[model samples]
Structures are given as C-alpha cells and as structure tokens.
Target: MEPVNGYYEASMNFDMEHVRPFLSQLEEAFSLGLDVDHLAKRVAEAEVETAYGCDLHLAFEGQPVNMKFSAWIDDIDAPDLYFYVTSEKLAEGIDAEMEKFCEAHGL
Candidate 1:
C-alpha cells in the first residue's frame, strides 16, 4: 500500500498514479453534458483498471453521483472488490482536510 499526493490517506495497495491524469481529464471532460454510457466508454479507453493497478469503478451496486468517486482495493493478488462513496460527502471531507493541510502548511 502507498500514499498518493499526501491527500489519499488510506492504504492504496497499488500505485494509482496512472489513473490520476485520467481523473483530471474526466473532470475536464465534464465541462459539457456527457452521457453516462459514453463516460463509461471513455473510462474504459483510459484503461483505468490497469492504470490504477486495480479493477475499480465509479459506481458500485449501480448508479453514479454528481460529486462522488469510488474505487475497489485489495492486497496484492486478492480478489477484486467494490468501493462506494457519495461525492458530496467526499467533497466535504476533502474540504475539511484541505483546510487543515493548508493551515498546517501555513498557506
């Protein structure tokens, strides 16, 4: 497991940097109304699984959200899994963390 950008605190269990750029690209791609299916296709084209070094998806069980992101993680060689989160909740959490990180960094 490894940390990412000092922002992701949980053990990654894999290097996901390759997906970071994809994530950024997705954020940009959202400038216009994009079909969910097409978004999925784009994600597939990004090779998110291989890039993240894990098989994961934005939705688990089923359904996506406006502000949330999710991923599955496991120990090396373990079975793939699902991870889910609400974007609103994640944004709130991240804002709090950023506030603290910035304060600590004297920013």
Candidate 2:
C-alpha cells in the first residue's frame, strides 16, 4: 500500500476454512503479543519463511499483498488457503470481517 516495507511476502498453505482463523490469530498476535502471535510483522515473515522454506504472499481483493503467513494441512492433505494482508487500512477491514465471519460460523 504505502511502498512495500519489505520485498517479501509470507505464505502458508491451509484449508479454505483456515484462512479466516489464521488471520484472526495473526491479528490477535499483533494486538496482544501473546500465544501464537509471537512474531512482529517482520518476524512473522522471517519465521514463516524459514519454517516453510518459501516466501509467503497474501492476496487481498484479488490482489497479492505483503504479509507474514502460514499454511497447514499441506497441499496434499487439504486445498491450502492463504491469508495475505498489507496496510493498516486493510488490517482494520480484516479484523471487522473476521469478527463477523466468526459470529456467523459460531467460531
């Protein structure tokens, strides 16, 4: 959004349903800095990259955005989903959306 902070994107393959929850976890991590949201934005990228051995990228509104992400279940087990985000503005929308989605699904 505002000139990429870094050139890399964090990628994780997960199930379709996991996309939202993973994003929620990330926001939780950033806000409370507890539990799995341990890595700062930068650290998230670094850690996920190292752990997965691939650069991660987030796609938002049909566009790819910079982010730190993770994939679960792998490609063989589940059709992995991705959670890619950039910009505080987008993050705001993501938080609101997550709440609504969670409420709808009783998550």
Candidate 3:
C-alpha cells in the first residue's frame, strides 16, 4: 500500500450540527463501528478558528490513522461551515462516502 503523508481540503455549505452526523455517516460507510455520540462530543468541544486544532481518527481497510481537522462558520449571515482534514486517504474516503450518502439521501 502506498502510504501518503499529504493533506486534503474541502469546503461545504453546512452547519456545525451537520459535522458530527456527516462524520458518523462516513464512519458507518467504511464499517469503522465508531460511536457517533463520542465523536459529536469531541467536535463540540474543539476550539474554533485557532491554532490549537482538532484530531479525527479513521480506519481505512483496517489500518488506523488520524487526521487533524478544523471547522468554522464561513459567513455570519449564512450557515456555510468550512472544514478540512489533514489525511489524503481519509479525505478521499470521506469525499466518496459523502457522494454516495448524498445521492442516497437526496441531500
């Protein structure tokens, strides 16, 4: 397996509340068996828009890895929340899962 040490970035039109569920859905799609509530609580406590950063761990094909992520409201007048992950593989997986989930859920 070609292990990558690069970062991936993406922005979305979502809110802080959507982050946890979206992450939970991605984990479920990958059969990672993670606790949604625990992930939610972690994200809820992260410092916003600062240098202190947050971490998100994910397993890809049974290999566990972590990605540092951060989220913030892009505009005070809008609900657009921008977020990004530091792992290339995890980011790619999340993008694919999100596409499938959005199509399935009509989002």
Best by TM-score: 3
Off by over 4 Å in 3: 1-5, 32-35, 42-52, 74-87
Q: Which ranges in model 2 have alpha carbons more than 4 Å from their true place?
A: 1-64, 71-84
**lDDT, candidate 3, residue 75?**
41
TM-score of 1: 0.25
lDDT at 40, model 3: 56
Q: For model 3, how big is the CA root-mean-square deviation?
A: 4.7
Which stretches of candidate 1 lie above 4 Å from their native place? 1-15, 32-67, 75-107
lDDT (10s digit) by residue, model 3, range 1-107: 23335556544554455666676786677765556677555556555443224565656678876655544533432233233554566667766776775676677
Q: TM per model? A: 0.25, 0.34, 0.57
Q: In lDDT terms, how accurate is model 2?
A: 0.44
Per-prediction CA RMSD (Å): 14.4, 12.0, 4.7
Best-to-worst order by TM-score is: 3, 2, 1
